[model samples]
Target chain A: MITLYDFELSGNCYKPRLLMSILGLTYETVPVDFYPGREHKSEAFLKLNPFGELPVLVDDGLVLRDSQAILIYLASKYDKTGQWYPLSDPAVLAEIAIWHDFANRITATASAARLGLSMFYDVDIEAAQAGAHQLFRLLDEHLWFGEREGRDWLCAPSHPTTADIACFPYVALSEEAGVPRQDYPAIRRWLDRVKRIPGFTVMSGVFPAGPAIEA
Target chain B: MNRPNPYLNDHWHVVAGNEAVASGQPFRTVLFDVPIIIQRLADGLRVTAALAPEKPLPVLERYGFIWTSLGTPMPLFEIPEYDEADRRNMNAGSLGVAVSAPRAIENFLDMGHFPYVHTDILGAEPHTEVKEYDVEVSAERGEVLATRCRFFQPRAATSSAGGQEVEYVYRVPHPYCSVLYKSCPSDENRRDVIAIFCQPVGEERIVAHMLQSLIDDVSTITDMRRFQQTIFGQDKPILENQYPKKLPLDPRAETPIRADKSAIAYRRWLSQMGVNYGVIPLVPRVADV
Candidate 1:
């Protein structure tokens, strides 16, 4: 049995939950009140994760701290198709690794802006929103060209990797942070593609897209 | 602190689609930051102040939209094709954006972003150029019109199967509303009417209503809607990320290019009309300062 130390609203927490859902793993959640309660920073929670983060995944005596590390472990173990986190291709693996780091940047900027706007965190909102836009512009350009080259997703070009899952949540919730996805048309289309991914679970803000009509 | 412009309050803004509120069902929406409710009657629709239940607001049903005004409004704009039975008049629905209404209208009037923003659907790279267009302000008609515009598109419409040079004519009939008359896919002699009515929900937020009246029998409603929605979806992010949220009416606010003739004319029209609900205060030049 697997367990996730979760916060309902946190995009970071949703990352592993999304991967686990896609992997068809039945995991229980220990809901941590991240906002009013601040339970993640408490003494008991501190023992689980010294970083005081919301997501500390415990899989049958194996504990993981970072969301990316948890994803790597889960995809390696449960993804039977070998498509989500295929290990044989070093090129694809390197691409996934780079995007995993890019996901962390998204957390710092887009998620930070979201928390600053909605949760009343002391964030440099203007700076954070600007940073998020910068990242989105880069991602949009990447995806736009990728589509032209017959590549649909971020990594592997043919099939969606864990990179798409990792980078999705914050981009979907960007409007909550006062950042609109207006200029990034490619990114908007990509979001719809991600929402259409099977086993996609809905959180507080991210809703499922309508059925995609195939060409 | 948005000072609701009296001029804008007096103009017809599209509040909802015809199907937005059902008969006997109360539909809720906000206009100029004041939340209002729309009640659909057996004959037509009635809008009332949510807080003041006794007062009935001025409402009109026209061209697949339910329009209302907070104050006494001028006449609504006209699209001649709506009256035609052969045209497929579709309400592409509404979407809320963080930018001011004028900004949304301006984005709709722009064709330069096709290659970059819309990519392969509306336009592709290496074929990027907005040919010169003629813009006019019809004082008698109370509208700003731009004609003789053209752009290369990969897929101009859902019915289109390949690339073609699309001709366009843009019109700004109201401060927050702009309409596009583009080449119809099935018919070479006729043009499709696409409009974006920006409802100024707040000073810096708007709900854009897209209505596409087309001369096409080849495409289904689903395909047409998906095509227009895809185009608008691409424009949303660019519109929201624009700084200040509100549009700058002053010609000096942003540099103008040959392709921005319609945008420039629209700004000039808004300035002439004194519509200031969602615009920045004009800045004095260095020489004047």
Candidate 2:
């Protein structure tokens, strides 16, 4: 059995939960009061992850930190198809690495704006919003071209990799940060596709996408 | 002692989908520029203007939508096809448009922009020509009907395997409602029904609720909604930047062609009904100095 040190509202915590739900893995959630209590920064939680970031995942005895890294670990170990992580091909791994880093940028900007607005964290709202827009423009164009090329994910894979999972939360939650996605049509479409994935779940502000047209 | 309230007209507008507002949950939105609240009561969903929070408007749960009218309204229009046992009734999500309610309705009535605005999905560049179609205003029915319309689409729906010829029937049963019956992707003999119910939030803003009654067993509800959302998302940016945010009632305000007959008839019907709720009158040209 796997255990997740979780925060209900945090998008970072949601990434692992979302993937776990998708992979059909059973896990126990130890809810950490991330908002008013700030339990993640407490002494006990810091011992689990010295970086003091959520969410920490423990399976058997191996403890893991960072959302993207946890996603890598989970998919690599659990995914029977070997598709979600796709570590076999060096080229695909490299591509996934690029997007993994990009997800960090999304956390820095979009997540920062959300933290400032909802959680009362002090942040430069203007700069964060601008940075998010700049990143979203690129992602939209990338997905637009990807649609034309018959690719559905961030990397050049037929199936979704960790890259798509890594970057999805902040982009989907950008509106909470005062960033409107009205201009990003392709990104909006991609977000719907992501939400339509089976076993998909919703967070506090993230709503589920409606059904697609029949195949 | 008081002037007439023009916005409080007798028009049944869709406010939300049945799935959007659950029982014991309250949903708030603006309709006809009035802030309103919707709550699912034991009997049905109750809607009322925000000013008078206690009073409830007439509610009708039809076509997978929750509809309410501030004034006395005629019976809701009928779509006989929805009663079919084999069809899947789907409530596509609401889409917010920066343009006026009528402009969004007019856009839905139009086929000319499919080639450009929707691009390869609805229409391609080479198949830009919209063949002449018959359009008429039904005085007895108080509606506008456009028939015998056809177009070639690269991908008609999420179920579409490739390009095919799509037959279409457009109807404007209400000033804010535009319904379309088109070729079904799952079964060639059946017609898929899609309708857009425009909620006029302001003179230049609307929340469009879409419903699709389709004949498909394979596609998930999420896929169906996402497909429609994708098409609307493609149309949003163009709709927002249109000049004269509210649609002009006068025909000469915007040039029309043979393909715009449905749009023409719709405007004429709105004009005859004296529906100035969400329309902008044509501005008179001033003589140059």
Candidate 3:
């Protein structure tokens, strides 16, 4: 069975869990505790992924670190025709890539910065809030346009690709990280659409109970 | 003692009292940091601040005065644009305007439609009278309790035409939330009031924030919640698809029957409040279906 090292509360960790469920793949969750700072920074875990993230996926001895990359890998390995990954069209892939970048560069970073300020460090909260707001506004604008234009999924038309899986968890959990979920109604609608998909499993924070355990 | 004008510092307003001004009189008393007049006539309630020189005499005479005038006459136009803080607070969200309607409280009491439009989704049966109403009120909020009669109806069962008595408890969270309580006569009411928060986003557009809780006692709450979700899902697409301009009503375009009483009443009420009422464009005869 595919092994997913995850923290339930972490949106990044939820990415793989959601994808695994959607893909109907059975995977064993190896729970990691971030409170005591135990497994993340361990030397053996670092050898698997130097970044010390909890969502490191180990399948057939192949290690995947970044959440987006792990999602792409999972889709390619399990799904046929890359419905989630969509390898047929370069333009489609490019669109998906933009959202993937947004998840990593903008949403992930801003969410982490804001979460760090609130949860871990005593950094300038105003600055962190500002960063979070800025990111939310950007996502809101995109979602607003997407909803108005009658687009079915983010990053593509009608069908949800890896791009949606890549970004949905963070955008959904951004509220817990102090990223004002209510401010973005269109994004909320988009999250609902994502939830209605067949074989859908909500990210840990989206619902109180799910397969994943809270980090 | 002279009370400081709360409206001067904040943008929020509250209802102070509901009193009968004259025998056979029907007026809603609203305290907006200042006394205001709300007279309910055959058409609807006409709200005016107590500052206008044109007394209620003309309005009373013109409408063939019958009811009692409750508080002193107030000017409808003299009520200044709310203070900046209230303006900011009110405009903080896109759906704020819907919540700002004076009749929102009354509208929440309506539970007749639970089984019709949202029947399969909410599991409400028609023609059923509410058996019990439990109300809980506090300084911050209030709740109303409603219970439905028990039956072993499952999703697979065909819908019976007969009605079931349902119970409802409405809760208000002071300025923001109005949570519905969960109680079940059979098990327990586990349903939550579907609260709608309106935030003003633009001159004409308001975002509508809605939340409903899952309750255990009422199996119907689950179905009703699903139905509400479906209705909202449909409404969002249509509302979002419409032009951002406030829609006007076209009386000749579509004939409204008794089933549309609530929506029609709400529209008339809004019009009386000086809210711009939009009319849905007339569909072609061929598009009637």
Q: Residue A197 of candidate 3: its Cα lDDT? A: 72
TM-score of chain A of each: 0.98, 0.98, 0.87
Model 2 misplacement above 4 A = A1-215, B1-8, B283-289
Task: Compute each candidate's TM-score over C-alphas.
Answer: 0.64, 0.62, 0.42
Better of 1 and 3 by TM-score: 1
Can you give the DockQ of every candidate in the order shown? 0.04, 0.05, 0.06
Q: What is the lDDT of residue B230 in candidate 1?
A: 59
How well is each residue in B59-154 modelled by candidate 3, as lDDT tens digits?
Answer: 332111111223333322111222222211111111112122222332343444334323443344544333333333332212222233222211
Clash numbers, per candidate: 6, 11, 47
Which residue segments of model 1 deviate by more than 4 Å?
A: A1-160, A163-173, A176-215, B283-289
Instruction: Give the alpha carbon lDDT tens digit for every residue of A1-215 in model 3.
Output: 79988754467887888888888899997666432234588897788789987689999989889888898899888997578887777898899898898887555455565455323333554565677677678877887998788776877567899888877876765543445667778777777778877788653236322233344
Error of 1 at A191 (Å): 12
Say what the interface RMSD of candidate 1 is.
12.5
Comparing 1 with 3 on DockQ, the higher-scoring candidate is 3
**Number of clashing residue pairs, candidate 1:** 6
Instruction: Sort by TM-score, best first.
Output: 1, 2, 3
